[model samples]
Target: MKPKDIVLDFYKSDVLLDKKTVSELLHPEVTIDWNSSEGFIQMDYEDMMSLTDQMARAYIRSKIRISHILQEDNLVSLRFSHFVKTIENPREDMLLGNFFVIWEIKDEKLFKGFQMSHFS
Candidate 1:
């Protein structure tokens, strides 16, 4: 699948609350640098799964709207806004963030991914 397609699928799965599909789109060795209200958090695949589970427990109603996608070879830069409502709070609290993801694809499967996100 195209890199953009993979990303769109990731967001679609996330919106559907399908963890399996989200996980399938991720590379096993993925590295994520996520900047949030708390701080800059660095994570790998295992950590990503843990975070996803936590979000699920929080039962967030989320939507990701992609503004732009730029791809060259194996690198992808995505600009998106993630809107979410925390189940516990039930308030419309949105996270506006931009992501830059670099992928290493081999044999049509993602071997590795490095991502950085900034939120405001």
Candidate 2:
């Protein structure tokens, strides 16, 4: 898959439900630097997997709405919004956040990322 395709699929796929999907998408040495409404956090591959596990336990379903995506070389820039149905409120899908991220692909997996997001 193209670098952009890999990045898009990573977000669009059921990653929280399937650890194998995350394992396929993130490189072993992957790192992401994220700045959110709360604060800045840096995460490695294991951290990312842990996050997915947490989200899986908290949310019943989730979706990503991509607004824009651009790619150059191994770098991909994407803008999207996340919506989720929580386990406690499975009937309603709530807006989780809006995000803008730039990802670097290495060995056909997501190698590094710089992300910024705001909650709704």
Candidate 3:
């Protein structure tokens, strides 16, 4: 699959919460810059793995709804909404909010990412 397709699939995998699928799509030295209410942050592959596990444990059910996707060469940009249900109560629909992300693919794997988001 194309790198962009892999990323889209990765977002869809939020519903499944499959670590294997998530891991397989990432580059070993993946880097990420994330910005949200907490402010700007950065991460490496290990950090990404840790967050993946935490997210799986924190959200009972979740889905990423993509609004748009654009790709050029190995770079991709996407706009999406992240929706989830907490582990405490799986009924309440918590919209962690919408986001825009730019991803860089290296050797057909997701090697870098930058995200800006708003949380509710």
Candidate 4:
């Protein structure tokens, strides 16, 4: 698949809560650099798999809405929101926050990503 298609597939998986698809689209040497209000994090493919596994359990019915998408060559960028239930008396889902991710696709898979998040 093209880089943009792969990136779209990534978001689609998140929206559908389909970790398997996400895993399959990730390159074996994938690396993700994440920056958020909490802090900055660097993770490899294995770490990503583990984190996704935990997130699947935490947000079994979560939804991710993509608001914008752009692509150039093998790079793709997207803006989105990840909705999740609140901690206190959790309901279906509320707007968790907004996030941006720029992915570099190599060999038709997600090879690297730089992402940031914010709440408003």
Question: How are the candidates ranked when ordered by lDDT, highest leading?
Answer: 2, 3, 4, 1
Clashing pairs in 1: none
In candidate 2, list every pair of residues with a backbone clash: none
- Tell me the tens digit of each residue's lDDT in model 2 across 45-107: 999989988888888898898999999999999999899998888899899999999999999
Per the 3 Å backbone cut-off, how many clashing residue pairs does candidate 4 have? Answer: 0
- For all candidates in order, the CA lDDT equals 0.65, 0.91, 0.85, 0.82
TM-score of each: 0.73, 0.95, 0.91, 0.86
What's the TM for model 4?
0.86
RMSD of each: 3.0, 1.0, 1.5, 2.4
Better of 3 and 4 by TM-score: 3
lDDT of 1 by residue, 16-70 (tens): 3556765776687777665555677778877777777777777567677777777
Top lDDT: which candidate number? 2
Clashes of each: 0, 0, 0, 0
In model 3, how many backbone clashes occur?
Answer: 0
CA displacement after TM-score superposition, residue 73 of candidate 4 (Å): 0.2
Query: In candidate 3, where is summed lDDT lowest over 10 consecutive residues?
Result: 13-22
Sliding window of 10 residues with minimal summed lDDT for model 4: 10-19
- Compose the digit string of candidate 3's lDDT tens values, residues 1-120: 687887887788363366787788889999989998889989898888888888888887878888899999889999998889898888787888889999999988889999999997
